[model samples]
Target chain A: MNIRYPNGTAYHQSAKRPATTMSQTTNYGDRGMSLEAELNESNQYYLNQGVAVIHKKPTPVQIVKVDYPKRSAATIKEAYFRQPSTTDYNGVYQGYYLDFDAKETKNKTSFPLKNFHAHQIAHLRACVAAGGIGFAIIRFTDDVATFLLPASFLFHCWDDALQTDGRKSIRRSAIEAHGYQINPALNPLVPYLNAVDQLITATKK
Target chain B: MNIRYPNGTAYHQSAKRPATTMSQTTNYGDRGMSLEAELNESNQYYLNQGVAVIHKKPTPVQIVKVDYPKRSAATIKEAYFRQPSTTDYNGVYQGYYLDFDAKETKNKTSFPLKNFHAHQIAHLRACVAAGGIGFAIIRFTDDVATFLLPASFLFHCWDDALQTDGRKSIRRSAIEAHGYQINPALNPLVPYLNAVDQLITATKK
Candidate 1:
């Protein structure tokens, strides 16, 4: 089935998987769905439960050309995806401003630093500075595991990687130690806010 | 000159103005620019000064068809605008979750309730219930007056208008009485944060 984004961009589930990996029938907590989709579901649950008000910002598109037809809706003839200056998701939860992005990696042992863009990192950093909670929900496609990594820790890793001899990726062990692992659940799929509560508590300290 | 939104939607300044009114030669604090543009500039100013981290969410587009040509950028062939689920602007300021939309009107005596969508009001209500600050930056194009009306008051107006005998619009007199007027400034254009500071103070009480 063809899944199109809000911007009409095609999304292929198979393309998201590592090229070398063979298709496995076994599903891990709704493994077929992308991390973003899962998170959206989770946010909807939260909204319905009156737990939070969060939403994924629409995909940013730079429209270049458009044609207006008589008595019909305008048609976009040319457009391009623009690099987002902020994260994919943000909203208010318990008076705290929540800002974050969802990323998935197929690596078994570690997550690569290249998954994050410099501007995204900067935007997260600025949000943190302004007293908002910033984080990244990283999913390991291999095991269908997800982790909520705080922006403060992410900044540390991002800056460390800038060093000449610094490591290019974060070890899975390090993430396990520093980040909050999000267990998948039925209602919210990702069940990320349980981990977010832990982040909020830590920030207060 | 043609201006395209991030979603490639054309924005015509002339179309925004009331057709019955004659275009005045004198400018009222950059009259030609849309309220969205002015607020964007203000948000940028706030971000730069480390006063706040706010942004206008991109225009939502429902993409119907796209063509990917080999060795060339993908072209969006067809797309339509989607009704946004939330307000256009939201961010963190001094640890407060701020959500708002900017609206402008040509009516001199009153601001029409019709200018706001039901979803936008509901979204703002949800945000307020979650302990976030919610408001609207209403602009009167006649004198280029801007005001920040708290979402609480907006809810009252919205609900009132729903009644059989209620007024269809909010009078400028009432807006002047309830809403905090925003003076146009050179640096930020819409220095609405000063009004937001008042909101924060009131919420604390």
Candidate 2:
């Protein structure tokens, strides 16, 4: 299975975090922005410049219990994943539809399939089938290299690894072969739309 | 001008408090879920059922400064709105590409147009011109109603409001006349597809 993570950075933070009621004082959105926040800023830049329409998909949440601590009652005691989602960000660019996931990895060498679940792969597959442009933005924070990889490549890596689990990660070299490297700048940390243009160009050729 | 909340029980605290950082945490998915969360769940459910292939359009975020709370900084100290979004959700369903927004209001009588930005209305017009299904989900919490108002209805309201500082809200009566009411259900509270079916059916006649 050929999986690729440019430089390999942390993509998605772990699903679990410190309990909100336990010691939930930190306002993460106000201080630490997620990939969603960054991409949102980038999308705004693109919109102002008339580049593209892109957005982060909201995390799927299931509500279980509500405590209503103070008339607001209904606090969630427990609820779990309905299923893993397809991609992170997606929208329209130059009249063509686009979809992709942004992931960060602490691992410097490669990106693991563990990062993507089976349902998500199925989703990407369906998106591609529907004639949408699908890809991923992989960040290797250690080296600060982000690459845009096509969904097809993701599909291959995902499918192959199902049988044998040794080469579970997509190496840097494989990423170079199939993905485009994106450099961070003032806006669109991963200026992925450029890669999207190249992808559209390459596909046309 | 018209809009309607066919499904009683607008978006409410269906989501248990205080709210988790990520993931759907309970059996109740729509109530507590943010507008974005509900759309994604519905989109995926639609995609799986072969009903539609819609997605949430990402917001444009402007990242001003990245605060290094620590070596592994998880805080975004400064940021601002970069660009206005065109729409909240868009996708291809039943051969027709659709775009819309899902909003909830504590008010029961009318939905405030102020809730809708100028750019979203512009985007919806363009989408309608391009031959896509464009509408909005207005959840009136006080009345426990949700309406699938056509984009045209919103434009009319917007235009009228411009004429007079009279009001910037969509009256419930107008919504009832112009928009189709969505009956809430367990599977898809916003079973907009059924409404789409009726719209398609009406268009044929």
For B56-175, candidate 1 gives per-residue lDDT tens digits of 999898888899899998878888778899999999999899999999998889999999999999999899889899999998887778899999889999999999998889999999
Model 1, span A71-126: residue lDDT tens: 98888877887779899999999999999999999899999999999999989988
Q: Candidate 2, residues A1-205: lDDT per residue as tens digits?
A: 3343322223233334322323324322223345556677888787666666555654443434333467552334433333435567666666566777888776787888788877667766777766777888877655556788988888888777777655788987888789998766677544778888888899889
The runs of at least 3 residues in candidate 1 whose Cα sits more than 4 Å from the true structure, single-residue gaps closed, are A1-25, B1-28
Each candidate's fnat, listed in order, reads 0.76, 0.03
Over the true interface, candidate 2 deviates by an RMSD, in Å, of: 8.2
**TM-score of each model, paired residue for residue:** 0.88, 0.58
The 10-residue segment of model 2 chain A with minimum total lDDT is A5-14
Candidate 2 structure quality by residue, lDDT tens digits, B87-162: 7677655445567888888876778889988988877776666456678888775644667888877888999988
lDDT of candidate 2 at residue A129, scale 0 to 100 = 67
DockQ of 2: 0.07
